[model samples]
Target: MGFADELFDLTGKVVLVTGGSKGLGREMAFGAARCGADIVIASRNHDACAEVAREIEAETGRKAMPYSVHIGRWDQLPGLVDAVYERFGRLDVLINNAGMSPLYDSLESVSEKLFDSVMNLNMKGPFRLSVLVGERMAAAGGGSIVNVSSTGSIRPNAGILPYAMAKSALNTMTEGLAKAYGPTVRVNTLMSGPFDTSAHDWEPESLAEGVRPHALQRIGTPSEIIGSVLYLISDASSYTTMATLRVDGGIP
Candidate 1:
């Protein structure tokens, strides 16, 4: 391998990615495998996860496991962690990327259930999984944790209030975890801006208008997320921790 390639190499490393079935999570999972890591793709949809797993294995010649569980369900997280260790022996990287923001017409329209759902999935679940895996990672030597946050956190609008709040808390969690398990384990936030994911069904005209305010005047493609993710998880970022790296198409 070349000097630059050695820095980003993931040979023999294992990675666990929540929401790895599709969108940016899927892209990251594939990216990691291309760098030589075995992957565990966890998501609510077993079939979706399985498909992605198969594709990753076929394309990258790396081991890929598909596990299904709702990220919002706190009780289910431990089993997921156990299964990964049983399968891969060690987890070198974890990307807390599962999240949702259901549409609500008004602030008053947001119910307790809806708010709780958002919080549980976006913040609560990641915290539990991080503590569980991070402790193990520290004990086993070291690992890296990447919390997939949002530009929404820093640029909160009424439409995405609940999600923004949860991501804001996630940012704080990333910093605290870095300190808690550092000198060994690294923790950081991948703060993302608007991207064209399967989540949106935008026509060209609307898509162009949506990104007008961004400095780049364009939405990011899912593949654009790979470089930043690779940096955080690999040896390339050995001295970095508790940092929020933005790959947000210069969103302003």
Candidate 2:
């Protein structure tokens, strides 16, 4: 392999990405496959995950396994971890990219159930999955994990307060896991900005206003996240861990 390619090569690595059916997860799965990794794509929707798995297999000639999972359920996570190891025998990379940010009219209208939903999905699930997968990775020699966070974690707004709190906790988890699993496994966070993707539900005028504080003056595109994700998961970042890389267009 060429020197640059050698530095980032992921040949024979098995990557598991949560929420891999679409958006950042889908793109990261494809990117890893392109780098010669076998991938497992998981989401709540079986059909969606299967479709992306099929597409990645067709395009990159890489093995892609798809599983439907609800990250909100703690019991479901162990099986998800088991399924990856059972199918691929090893998992070298994990992208905890699944998340939710439901809208409520106001803070007063927020139900306890709604609050739990956000925390369970965004924070609790990731912690449980990471611990299980990270132990395996550390035992097997080494691995990398990239937890996807949000700019909202640092800049909470009324509409997504619960989501922000969950993401903030996720960031803290990233640091704790890095320390706990290090010397063999690395853990990091990708604090992302607003993006123009299938996940977006913003009007053009609203999006334009939202971009004003960002130095880039535009929403990120899904493909834009691939480089950082690849760097973190591959040998390119062999010495880096417990870091939060900002892909947020420098929002003020």
TM-score of each: 0.98, 0.98
| Model 2 weakest 10-residue run by lDDT | 193-202
**lDDT per residue as tens, model 2, 34-103:** 9999999999999999999999999999999999999989999999999888898999998999998888
> Residue 96 error for model 1, in Å?
0.3
**RMSD (Å) of each candidate, 1 decimal:** 0.9, 0.8
Q: State the TM-score for model 1.
A: 0.98
Candidate 1 lDDT at 231 equals 99
For each candidate, the alpha-carbon lDDT, in order, equals: 0.96, 0.94
Pairs clashing within candidate 1: none
If candidate 2 were superposed on the true structure by all CA atoms, what would the RMSD be? 0.8
